[model samples]
Target: MFFSKQWITGAGLALALLGGTPAWSADPAATTTAAPVAAAAAAAPAAAASAPASLDARVQDLKGDVIRLNRDLLVLEEELLFPASTQVALFVSMDVGKLFELDSVQIKLDDKLVTNYLYTPLEVQALHRGGVQRIYLGNLKAGKHEIVAFFTGKGPHERDYKRGTTIKFDKSTEPKYIELRIKDSQAKLQPEFEVKVWQ
Candidate 1:
């Protein structure tokens, strides 16, 4: 059905050749002329084997486009809400979390608790697979600030553990990025958590 235009064009061309010729008085010549047109018409059925023109396929393509557009809009909204000049973001990552199993994390900015997050099993699994999760996002004025993070989880030997780490960072006019990286220390037989400030 999609080859309607091609078929019409081929048929129209054959009709024009059969009708508009001044020397079509010979039956042999007319047969020779119709042979190539018949061959072209026979090939038109191959269009049925091409890619789909179904409604479901078009709807699926539209859905994929909408998802990408929504992600872009969300990123734009975040930039507007937390402008880069004053934005401060904290992220958590795990590099082979063998010695510690993360349960929750509490962040304190300038001795005041700002954000606390409890990780689900799915989130922990995502981090174990080399995914980084953004735990906190806020704005800070241009000055020196201290960030204290309390990590509570299961330590070595399946013992309950809570460890606190601090980092003093100078907040400039640029956006500040801090990463709480938890990596296994095979040599020391423990997990090491550090606050890394991105320049």
Candidate 2:
């Protein structure tokens, strides 16, 4: 059990009140007066100790409420800005990337530049380890659209290489997801870029 300063003071006061008179010299009047004072003094410490515990619990509960509220706000904002019916997302990933070291990526939607991303060493290593990165998210109309992606990297033999790939697909009432993939071609000893539209 932990004792705060207030608790220790109250305990010492109660002890003083109860032990002030020796047993052999006890007087009825002194005993009666000291009993109530000692009791009240001891109760003060108990009440003081419980107050802080209750306050700490309320603080923890309030922190949990704030986190939940922030998450709800984020979801509401996303729905208002990019509804599912018109939403389009593009992702980048790598597979067996021994032949390439990715440095940057550029994406175009219908010939308009959408996103240009530069990768840090850690991010490139993550993709090489099978991690996928979402590079673009926006609203698109319900019609045919063309997406182009350009990947720049160091290819086999430590030479600079750049490649572009394109795909055309129709969007309806559902969200569209497209993946730009970089893969090592073992047979050709080179890196290949491909685009895939997910249904």
Candidate 3:
């Protein structure tokens, strides 16, 4: 008595078979009302099973595209290292006051430590009033560079910071200083960065 849509349809088919219903009747004169009902009743559950399988296949296809995008971002990061002077820009923002502080910036070349700054920590009032900070890395050789930026303020919240956006410099004239900002108390910030080559 385990009655379900699937089980009910299956039972109906079993009964039809046991009664010797010809699945394909060539007899042009033989006609019955049971045949059409049997066909439709068999189709409903089969359609239900087919729909979920098709949907699952589509979802898996989308996941494959997402995985490819992540791989592309990785490749872009690797491509950024080489010698060049260029313009670099970084936009940083925070969600809360505590996460915003001054003088927490560092730049590294090819994993070798280049320079870092100890910024003056701003008061909560100052940040709310809108403060901006900029750092400049000038005359870089064509190679890979890493910039690490974060607040040096004491606390677990202060440890959160943005990773360096890697860059490769060719001969060109671009801006040097990058501008980054920290917004509010969310203990997290992402700085937008741009780099260009200089002649």
Residue 170 in model 1: lDDT: 94
Best-fitting candidate, measured by TM-score? 2
**TM-score for each candidate, following the candidate numbering:** 0.69, 0.79, 0.32
Writing each residue's lDDT as its tens digit, candidate 1 over 56-136 gives 688899999999999999999999999988999999999999899999999999999998899999999999999998989
* Candidate 2 displacement at residue 33 in angstroms: 4.7
lDDT of 3 by residue, 45-98 (tens): 999999999999999999999999999977675345422345444433333444
Candidate 2 global TM-score: 0.79
Highest lDDT against the true fold, candidate: 2
Q: Model 2 over residues 1-199: C-alpha lDDT tens digits?
A: 8779787667666766876654433358867887899899999999999999999999999999999999999999989999999999999999988999999999999999999999999999899889999999999999999998899989999999998998999999899999999998989999999988888
lDDT of each: 0.89, 0.91, 0.51
RMSD of each: 10.9, 9.6, 16.1
Model 2 ranges with Cα > 4 A deviation: 1-33, 39-54
